[model samples]
Target: MEFKPVTHVLFDMDGLILNTEDLYTVAFQNIVSQYGKDYTFELKLKLMGSQAHETAKIVVSHLDLPVTPEEFIAQTSKEFEKIFPDTEVLPGARCLIEHLSKHNVPIGLATSSSRESYELKVNKRHKELFSLFPYKTMGSSDSEVKRGKPYPDIFLVAASRFPDKPKPEQCLVFEDAVNGVKAARAAGMQVVMVPDPRVDESLRTEATLVLKSLEDFKPELFGLPPYDD
Candidate 1:
């Protein structure tokens, strides 16, 4: 929690900044259900923030279903599109992004979500602090970063976005999953995990600061804002 001399704010989209985790759950279940496999809420919680490839393997194993990985991914992805219209930003997420944008910190988004999906969804808000631009970022499919969280590919991509811009230690990452925390940490960045209440306590251990929610987040705690603010 102490490492708040932040020059950059890196974010994870699905669960941390947006309420798309449950949507993913619903979509995934619907997709798997069509194939007669059981995909539950608990399964989605276990699989959030992961790459489609990583998730398909688990889905196949858990449901005891037999299918090619590529087939499962394609089917689930089609289901996600049907559900993205129902997604919404999380509480305090808009204000947090607005506040940071007003401060002009270089911000980047690191997500396993495809660029097309991010553009369709995140661009609708226009509150995103950075794109793959002069500000810097890396969308999925742009890089060969094969592994997802618990593997640092995404966070590494985020930190490297503005390579000549800010140092990794000077960046702050907001995450809601243990795998995301592990990703940020492995990227040599400090992480504050604002986990969904449904995620268990064991996952919170990997975070540098495990707060209740972004509502409880105070820039003052990191000495970024004056006490009155």
Candidate 2:
């Protein structure tokens, strides 16, 4: 299949470009374990790609936590920060970002992750690579956006950042989770689904293209040569 120009590229940070989801799962398990709530792997499958704050609400509801959503979010953020630095990108992430940056491709990060969590988790070394992207959008952009994943607010915010440029169809989203893909699709952006099969089987039916990993991401898909030799 022929890929388009891909003038703008929006990436989902946590699962797609970064390997932080494992940290989230472990931290969540820690939280639930404290309450004697068994958050099984199967249970975790339901929360992948969800916003951290929203995920906290779901977990609190599932486990019957005696805490408010605000408190749950605060606790989750604290714990997530403790484990986030250990999370880096999956294979080919560095190379792909570097290559895309070299060609002057417009890249933006659209994440449901909070700015504080993102800074603590994705700062420093990541900046060397992500700095070239020149755009950032987070879920905090809208207050009415309550649910994550199924909601398109984050992607819409990211797309709107390019107001002077291409239409929604001109921008493409790279997402690994089913919900992230759903959000991108809802925003009317062309989506390239990078499914983490271990976490997302349902996403296959919703994506424009499915790839095993970013290892298969080619610069030519955006009409550019492979960078870094």
Candidate with best lDDT: 2
Taking the tens digit of each residue's C-alpha lDDT, what string does model 2 give over 73-143?
87777787688877787887777777777777777888777777777777855767667668787664445
lDDT of 2: 0.74
For candidate 1, write residues 1-229 as lDDT tens digits: 3555667778888887778777777777777777787777677766766776778888888887778778888786677667675568887677776676666556777777776666655565543433422343334465656677778877776677675656767778888887789888888888889887877898687787888877777765554543234
Cα error of candidate 1 at position 217, Å: 1.0
Instruction: For model 1, give the 10-residue run with minimal summed lDDT.
Output: 127-136
The Cα local distance difference test for each model comes to 0.72, 0.74
lDDT of 2 at 135: 79
- Which candidate number has the best TM-score? 2
- For candidate 2, the per-residue lDDT at 2 reads 56
